[model samples]
Target: MASHLFVSSTRSFSCLSLILKPSPPLLGVKTLFSRSTRFPRTYKPLVRHGSNAHPKLLSALSSAPPVVAWKSSELSSARDDVVILGIETSCDDTAAAVVRGNGEILSQMVSSQADLLSRYGGVAPKMAEEAHSLVIDEVVQRALDNANLSGNDLSAVAVTIGPGLSLCLRVGVQKARKLAGRFNLPIVNVHHMEAHALVARLIERDLQFPFLALLISGGHNLLILAHELGHYLQLGTTIDDAIGEAYDKTARWLGLDMGKGGGPALEELALEGDANSINFSIPMRQHKDCNFSYAGLKTQVRVVMESKNISIENNPISSANSEDRRLRADIAASFQRVAVLHLEERCQRAIDWAIKIEPSIKHMVVSGGVASNKHVRARLRHVVETNDLQLICPPPSLCTDNGVMIAWTGIEHFLSGRFDPPPPADEPDDAMFELRPRWPLGEEYPKGKSEARSVKRARVHPSLTSMIQGSFQQQL
Candidate 1:
């Protein structure tokens, strides 16, 4: 996922035999010259097995160049068609899906760790890994079954490699590697966040390259310019906590149900309170840069809850006291308002900055978990409309982590010939491969351009703004 380019110059080889020639003893040790019969004729000697060779030198030589071998039939079939099986264990879910080259999702399956949420209150990495391990095989099998296909029918296998919990990511990566090796399928490593941003293309075929993307999820808050399938230019990132983190924390403090996750729970509760009942300032209003900060806003909400003596024990809104319920809803509503405003501000700035870099940019694709919020979507719709750009967001289900997105991203990369050979059958189960847990989506902000040029904030139609502000008033 971290490296998009696939160079096939190096391939794994099956060793048939080794011949060793003994040499005169040196330093009370006999030296040996070794050669493998399977070595390519073009192979040149780089290191020899001698008594003087250091252990580290031998370790380095262990990773010799792979011998390339491909049957004519296999090569021909490979070029005919591609259907990818994508696995995603990048977070709290175990998911697998089958997707064809033409952006059709043949089958999809997901096993979420919602059970752990009630017990642990949040994602427990080790526990989440165990959950993934328990259900991954079944999930994959179900996906294949739903598609009426099997491993043999798949052209390649893909899995999220990083920018997620390392423990959880390993479950998906290892499972995918095993399937690829067993089925002799090429592997496409997928970046979790990149998959989120690109999945929109599948939904909106007219969406083109050089569009702007605002990726907001539990772990990420980013505004990137998608120049191409594997290229991006980051314009802004969260300076502190991600927007979803703020939402989750606020939800927990507000005593919202943990079953549906903090963001969704808060969104539901916010609908019950007047958005204008409590005022929460938008973050980074003074800073014209596109960067975001939600920690301050989160702290502000905590302070307000403490001052108002808001009880977070066992869903305050459902308690016997009516006024207590109203207070909780008010906090949820106020928090949602400011959280979405920050997104609007940064998205507006990102749109202006991206237009300068690529004038043809006419669409803003919003993805990731937070993008599923109706209020957030409404506000962003207004932002893009004011700027003469269309806003594209995947459906609510696709906005969350799922195998469909990974599979689609894999299809995109597979078409571009970005893939790696299947792991050898005899490869150890614990063999090390490139798995980045903290990979960046693309290049960071360009040097000397840390701050985007100031752009006037897009003006929302007063009617629309008033409607949102007054949304919860009627409920009260």
Candidate 2:
């Protein structure tokens, strides 16, 4: 690691004061402080072991590395010309994008690990990390190139720091720090789930805070109330696996194509069969809380598949005979129905609870990889509309894991002066960075649990019950 100089100062200043160490031949750069440590009001002496009382100062020094000095003016919160490059390697996707402060998407790029996912059945952390290391550079460069700009043109670098795989998060963080250092740009650390929720504001310019958001993906299912920038109250979360993971596992059990991801393939297959065919129970029916549980539903599908003698081996859709294919399709359709129904149920309760807390809430943003599903969007739309709230779902491309959301979320934080100074250009490869593999979006709502218990569970639609009984009897 590169040696770092520690500066101790108790005085406050309106701007940054930095001392530069001259390169080899020129020892001419004099220290601002005299040999006796006499210095100006804003200047402080260098210390080998400083007082541990200055945590903020220490954090700034340790996390951001060293070298370049940033003035307070440079950290202005209202710079309208701010352009950020957002980098996301939270999971299997390596994505990068350029987004203007005004929500203009200059360029975006994603290098997916669909092949790896298909081969391994899911994301293998070690393999996923290696894959990210290989393509992250190329993807970021492409994003910059397509934006008709270079790293130096960017005002700041925004990257997802947590709520994802630590190894994958590190790949993006290191690349971001390296770029920010090279370009002398500020850095903004982002929470992965917050990025998913805040990106809606980018698409819907009128999307104000105090709105409800249901973020669904392979690893997370969250219902949060966005109180304001950097302030949120989580209303619901997954007690078990996320909806996207359930979708992938269901697709695999049905022998659907694993290419292009299991969610899309399963959605397409569901389109061909009766959605009410299997009657798998919606998860968390007995519980009136917004918390989700897809694990049981996944098990239900496995049981029904086994009862029908469907092999769990790698049986592709193409190899299945006509009857087998239809049976699989029925299972797919039914599984998707219950999975989404669970989401719908949770969202309805969340909205009810949210509105009581923030009656001004008028829009509900549904985002994440699973939000790309037309069925999921449609179902959630009804729930939002019934509560007199407009539903805002980003375009299909933005719904999935991508760099644009990171870039956009970065813009939100940049405007609030929440960012770090650029690191040293020669920041070592082993330099430690802040990485959060399990960061929460925000704090849990204090009344969320109490309010949930008071909310009555709506009756399951009669048609759904009848369909469930019919499907179960037929299978037996």
**lDDT of all predictions, in order shown?**
0.72, 0.74
lDDT (Cα, 0-100) at 250 in candidate 2: 89
Per-residue lDDT tens digits for candidate 2, residues 1-476, read 11111111121111121221212211111111111111111111122233322333333333432222334343232233457889999998889988876677777888888888888888889999999998888888878777777764676799988778889999999999999888667778888888888899999988887789999999999899887766678888877689999999988888777777999999999998888888788877777778888888999999999999999887788898989999998999999888988888889889889989999999999999999999988888888888889999999888998899999988776544345667899999999877767666656666555332232224312221132234334433
Question: Candidate 2 has what TM-score?
Answer: 0.79
Any runs in candidate 1 off by more than 4 Å, and if so which?
A: 1-80, 313-316, 447-476
Worst 10 residues of 1 by lDDT: 1-10
What tens digits encode model 1's per-residue C-alpha lDDT throughout 1-476? 01011111111111111111222211211111111111101111133223333333233223222322335454333323456888999988888887765566777787778768656767789988888888888888888777777776676788998778889999899889888887666777888888999999889988988799999998889888887766677788776689988888888778777777889999998988988888888887877777878888998898898889775555534553777777888889999988898899888888888888899998999999999999999999999999999999999878988888999888776544345666776668889976677666666555213343332224312221122224324323
Give the lDDT of residue 71 in candidate 1. Answer: 50
